[model samples]
Target: MGLEIRLLTARDTEAYWHLRLEALEREPKSFGESAGEHRLSTPESATERLTTNPEDNFVFGALLDGDLAGMAGFFRYTIAKERHKGKIWGVYVREDCRGKGIGRALLAALLEKIKACPGVEQVSLTVAAGQSAARALYVSLGFKTYGLEPGGMKVGDEYLDNEHMMLKI
Candidate 1:
């Protein structure tokens, strides 16, 4: 069967949980949250995350054979004046499923969701510095790096930097 790209929901909690844990564990510096922080998260909260409250948040998933293969999430600022922009985060593809366009698919779908939002005119995201593949992917999809956050994160003693990119919708 072909891969399916669509919105994730509360019913996808089980698969989503495991897939997200993989992202946190396998690519610690690439994400904002550590696996330990996510491990403390409850299943109910994960499910709640999948339940889209479109004005502010949504998640898109890429599935193959009914398993979650990748995902991307978007969050819009709820403050009155900042609603015109959104941020994309939590982008990941399953290890065994990489190099197969799943991440691009998830990102494309997420962008479409953002376009559907009435006031969202732009979307921004941050990628770990030196992550060429992911940065290239975002660049290929029309995102441009506007700045860099030097030593944006510290994992143990290693300082991780990030590149800030934005796309005009």
Candidate 2:
């Protein structure tokens, strides 16, 4: 099957929210949140998020066998101190779809969009320190760990370390 990458639209609000919450729930250790954390958001929140910046903040999704198995997004760093960079987030592939190059495709597509952003010189993301597979993929894509944060997040009963990484374009 062929892999297709496309921009997320208003029509994808529910799917986007569902897939992201699924990722956060399924891989609680790899993400910043626990399964129950996202319950605070209402459908309005999801729609607002989807509609606010569909064009500037890009979300690239990968379809495998007619199903969307992975997604990644990046938002331009709007602060004056970090205007030359974008922060990547919501990067995840379905559990059954991992290791099949879908994650790579999703990340590459997001990076390409980031590179096209005027004045965007780098992309930054924080990954769970113990996620070696994701870390290796970032390295292969030219991302380097810049530093580490201790007890960055508490997922359920465990505190996880976070590795800050960046890719200079």
Candidate 3:
């Protein structure tokens, strides 16, 4: 596979939006957003999401043979007291592209960019409690479990808990 990991831009809005919707549809439990909600979003909104502001927020995409196979996003907290912390969100790799290192590469690239952001002392993320593979990958990348949020998300009548983790840079 001709794999490439790079920052996503406005030109990548369509691919990013499609992959994001796929993630929300196929792995609803893994994401905080619902597919229904995403379906209601406009192309302009998707384009805005891909707008890169490195010091504040950005997304990294993993392309396999020029096709978007995975993506990960990062954003720094805007609150004055929380400005030193960054959060990782919307991480997903296509089901057909799993078992490869696409997730790792996307995350590695995101982390490298995060390290360059001024005042970013640590990175944090939440993984659904049942997602062992995702949790393992985060742990392998030096994130430590800080706490568990009970009922972090709800899908229909079911509630899913999330494990909060952080990596101090």
Candidate 4:
């Protein structure tokens, strides 16, 4: 059977936090910071993110046989000038579950969700420069490279570049 993709709700908070921390711990380079940083956050913080208003942001998950395998979400800009855009973040997939389209499923679901939000005309995301598979996946789904941020993130003693990508909704 194929993976099941759906929009997450408040009831998913615990599972969402578990998988999110797992991603941050196992693949720190894939995201902006380390799980250790979030470890300092209170349970309220995790629940708040998972329960964010769907009108402003929506989180989607891809479950493989009822197990959360991947997740992604978007935060719509609040500024009047940028209200037409949304920033995609919190993207992750288990290392062992990647390449099977879970990432694509999560992205696609979140994309549709954002596209339906009021005033959201575009969606943007950042991917590591060397992650060709991720870049290709985004490009194939209609995102285009808008720019590159050199040394955008520091992982321990190393710096990594990131590519800014956007898709018009």
Question: What clash pairs does model 2 have?
Answer: none
Provide TM-scores for the models: 0.96, 0.91, 0.97, 0.93
CA RMSD per model (angstroms): 1.1, 1.6, 1.0, 1.4
Cα lDDT tens digits for candidate 4, 42-126: 7777778767776887788888888888899888888899889889988888888988878888887887778778778888999
- Cα distance off (Å), candidate 4, residue 43: 2.2
Candidate 2, which ten residues in sequence have the lowest lDDT sum? 47-56
**How do these models rank on TM-score, best leading?**
3, 1, 4, 2
lDDT string, candidate 2, 11-96, tens digits: 77777778888988788888765557676777777667656765457788787775777888888867899888888888898888
Q: Is candidate 2 or candidate 3 better by TM-score?
A: 3
Tens-place lDDT per residue, model 3, 31-97, is 9999999999998998887784555899999999999999999989999999999999999999899
> After best superposition, candidate 3 residue 121: deviation in angstroms?
0.4
Best by lDDT: 3
Residues 1-169, candidate 1: write the lDDT tens digits: 5799998888889888888999999999889899999999999999888775755798888999888889999999888898898999999998889898898889988888799899899999999976788999999999998998899988889998989999998
Residue pairs with clashing backbones, model 3? none
Model 3 alpha-carbon miss at residue 51, Å: 1.0
> How far out, in Å, is residue 4 in model 2?
1.7
